[model samples]
Target: MRIPLYALLLCSVPFMVHAQSETDSVHHSYTLSTVNYTIAGQRYQKNYTRSRELQQSTDRLLERIPGVTMIRRGNFAMEPTLRGLSAAQINMTIDGMQLFGACTDRMDPISSYVEPNNMERIQLGFSPNGEQHNASVGGGLNFSLKQAQTGAAKVWSGLAGAGYETNASATQTIAALQYSRSRFAISANGVWRRAGNYTAGKGQEINFSQYNKWNLGLSAVYLLKPNQQLRVDYLQDEGYNIGYPALTMDVSFAKAKIGSASYIYTPTGMKLKSWESKVYYNYIDHAMDDTKRPAWQVPIHMDMPGTSQTMGLYSRAKWYYTNHFLEAQFTAYSNRLHAEMTMYPKNAAEMFMLTLPDVQRTVYGIDLKDKIYLGQDWTLSPSLTVNYVQSDIYTELGKETLSSLFTGSLDRKNLIWNAGLNAEKHINGRWTLFGQLSRGARSASAQELYAFYLFNRMDNFDYIGNKDLKQETSVNASLGMSYHQHRLHIQPQLFVYRFSNYIVGQRKQGYSTMTIGASGVKQYVNIPDALLYGGELYATYRPWDKWYIQSTNSISIGQDNAGNALPLIPPFKSINRIEYTPSKYGFYAESISQSRQDRVSTAVYGERASAGFTIFNVGAGRNFAIGKNTLNVHAAVYNILDKQYYEHLDILKLYRPGRNLALNLSLTF
Candidate 1:
């Protein structure tokens, strides 16, 4: 691989230095942050939370972000929704690459598959327009994997940690070994974890209670001198457990196989000031079973096996002028999926096996964007992308496969497009404003096209797939305002999103005569209209150097064309924190509360609501010298109040397990 000159500059910047610049500068500009956007005219500052010493999972920690409302946690998976959209609607990625869960129940979403300790930073890009990814119909989120840092020759580093909470108890061991030479670098991380079943605040016995997870990743980078490099990464996750809220079956076992290689090239002497190119590949294989579904006389298979693979070619170019920067990207991808199950014959009591032939798709896209500093205190950013996709499906039932080759795929020929504009303007030294507007579309997925059984994880009812579904289109607009003074900092954002041909899961018309296939399959249909509006407010005050107070709140409203409330809309939530950070010690305590909301309208389960409750958390940590070595330790308490309550989105709420206590400790050398 020939390395390009611009690649050297991007790979050379220090992570910590980039953070400092993003945090210290206070302009109405969106150029400072990597993934966060200024909403409705407000620039929100991002803070890094170290997970090595944290006692909770990444999905739980995501709830602490300014806009996250709730998290649906499972044994091997956790789905977090911002303002109320998750799972298939969200594009979850690891290290800039897309990863999909295998089980129909989504037992292994990318978030739960990757350990929190392994991540260096988490950036929540809530772009309702789906500008960053083609599949994010609801919104887009980006998770940045922590890269190895070997600034010093003898940078020996590793960490050991364990945590225990009333319902969730876990212990983990991890180590990072790195070797960097003048032209080559090697880094590896290995981790193992085990967790017991967790209960809710009021003593609910949520089900399938145990899980174990292990992950190992190795990276080798060969620097082909100045501007070129080749890197390879191997990451794997294996685990098993019970009581998934969204699924009818508990996953007995699951594993993720991921292998990626990227070659970057930058010529020291290129036509532009900086230019870089990259190529990458990814794949996943999964298998799991449900112990109770077969016994329940349902039409679904007791055992399921599924697999998918994706290959992508990515390239980007950037040109920096005196006061403006222009960048463009071109990407092409190919993916495929397969699933199988067993169903019993209606009258014979004999079971037969069935397999979905295979679903394959190819996608290509081009994006162009620009950022201009109109003035020292003002910034403008505009971006647009156009895409084309193609797909083919095959089904096998009676020894022979049923294959369909269509000249024009569902939405393959339709133009998937996006356009957005973001601007930041300074009001004064103490105030700033930022706003953005965008329009985007999402093409249908393989699951939506070929799935024939029930999505027991999303709901207990059977789900029928729709091969004729169309692409979903949406438009969003937001504005924000921020106040920054010597003693106070506050940021608030408000936004609205409108959808056309939105895909929604609701009960369909028609009944099945065969009592065995499934109770009745729920049809996937496109709703004529859907709309969502929301806002988030966050603030911090530092009356004293060592003592500070912070608060954050998020709220949203959603409805269908008929003015009926949408399902799973998270309630209004707020959290306040009081912290003391002295010269040598750190301590913090916080209380979180959410208002009760019974406004549900999924049609299947009508008008179900959750009760309001409050919980408290406290933590303390210190760093000191221990004979020639440094020592760090910390601990925290969760659900200090042990309040009993059920979450509206919790699939386990049907079992009523509530309240939990947890503590965590970590040490690094």
Candidate 2:
């Protein structure tokens, strides 16, 4: 029986209550949450203290956006599910551009490539299909890079910081430098992270060791015309890594090189009030090395290389009239992927093996949206979008036939659609209500159709893709209320999702071959029936000018035909934070709690019951001025009591790691 991830969280609630306490009082210069929205009517933001040592990436930053929940798998990249639709259903874009992650495990999302500190803001549309960005389908995330002062001349700035965490034996460092001149700007940022083996709650030392990574990026922007600009960027990451709880070989030496250039044009006068056009291209080359040991008399090491190239163009036209605001956009995108594998055969009769597959794909989309004000504090928004995709895939088994299995190439086409409507009303002087309904559909990605590989991290299992997978469709609706008082801001939202052709995993009969227990082969299959419902409460209160507190609670329930809770449907969770700022310094304490859940899905190996525990975090920082320099220093301690707990989404739970203390320090000029 599969155990639900949430059940463990619920069980930990009792412990959570005991770990929280009130700390010192100070005044904060400004709350990061309040700085996000310029227009207060329809925006929400959450902030993670710099002392938390959250991963520096766009995807991690999305967690600060209201109405979004991030289900993390590891330090790698998080998978986002908006209103019960995730993966390809969620549109992820960076700096107005889209790129595909090359990892077959979806380990490296485009968001993972962007450093969080490099971003000015991350925005999300609560209603799926409300707006279109490039080839986005269900929901859209926009990553905006930080910009220098509007008219500053020859400005220079930089920041440096480092953090250490006991859990997962993690340590990291970050630094950034920037320069801005009239009509020109340049910036560079980088991060280095490393961790040793970690011991779980059971006192088992998981092999999660020696995971070292480094990434560096450089960007430049130039204004060619008053209304036009050009930007170019380059990024690279090199690392040697290992995933805990892996039954076989650890992954090592992964590397990537990326580059992109974009031209953006905005004309002040046109048929529409304004029009903006953009085009960009990016390339990624990835490779990894692993040594398989299970089921073999001796170690079998191998190497693999994968590459992806992408190009895209998008444009938007905006029109404004007396009571109506309208906008339309079109996008074109294409990508190509190539991969090769090299290995050693154990038997003298057998020779080295290799598998290669080449894939190419293209997509086109058009979308339209309108907002109308009907008086009486009433407003309405409607949107529609359509998209199409085509792909060609081919594969070659170097040895002609390793297991005498038959395979064939595939060529397919797909069409997708989305529509949504939103209505809002101001009920009173301090309260407002809103409702939204949206329907979205997305076609399967190329990796879902043709991928076939051994995922050693999950227990030396082979994952096979199915070509017959169907498009997934979902309808979502939400009702919410917002309140603003002199010292508080609050929003509560409830939502439900009805799905058709939802995709899930199913075990295949007779395909059960494993070195461990009776682990059958599970493949992605389409489910015709599915439903999900949930609600969230979020608020920020400033009881006094010197103290601020924020709280958020969320719960979601999902089920299939049997009406059993879906496995890993994030259990009820809450986050509370109290912060105090003193002129140029800040101090904060935060607690996150999870309720235990018991939902389980198909049989999975090493799947066991999970328990919960509460973690305490406290930190303080201050900025000081030297004669000619500005410097800042901060420090924090995580898992204050050194609690032993399990993260529902932590893929290393099989080893049961415990939390450890962490510290951070920073300098800025």
lDDT of 1 by residue, 311-422 (tens): 6666777777777787777777766667776544446665533344466667777878777788767888787878777766533341133222122333334567878777
Worst 10 residues of 2 by lDDT: 20-29
The lDDT for every candidate, in the order shown, is 0.60, 0.59
lDDT of 2 by residue, 225-319 (tens): 86777877777776666442333334555565656566656666553566666666666665555553344522444566667777877777787
Report the number of clashing residue pairs per model. Answer: 37, 21
Q: State which candidate has the highest lDDT.
A: 1
Q: How well does candidate 1 match the true structure, expressed as C-alpha RMSD? A: 5.8
Cα RMSD (Å) per model? 5.8, 7.7
Choose the strongest candidate by TM-score: 1
TM-score of each candidate?
A: 0.86, 0.83
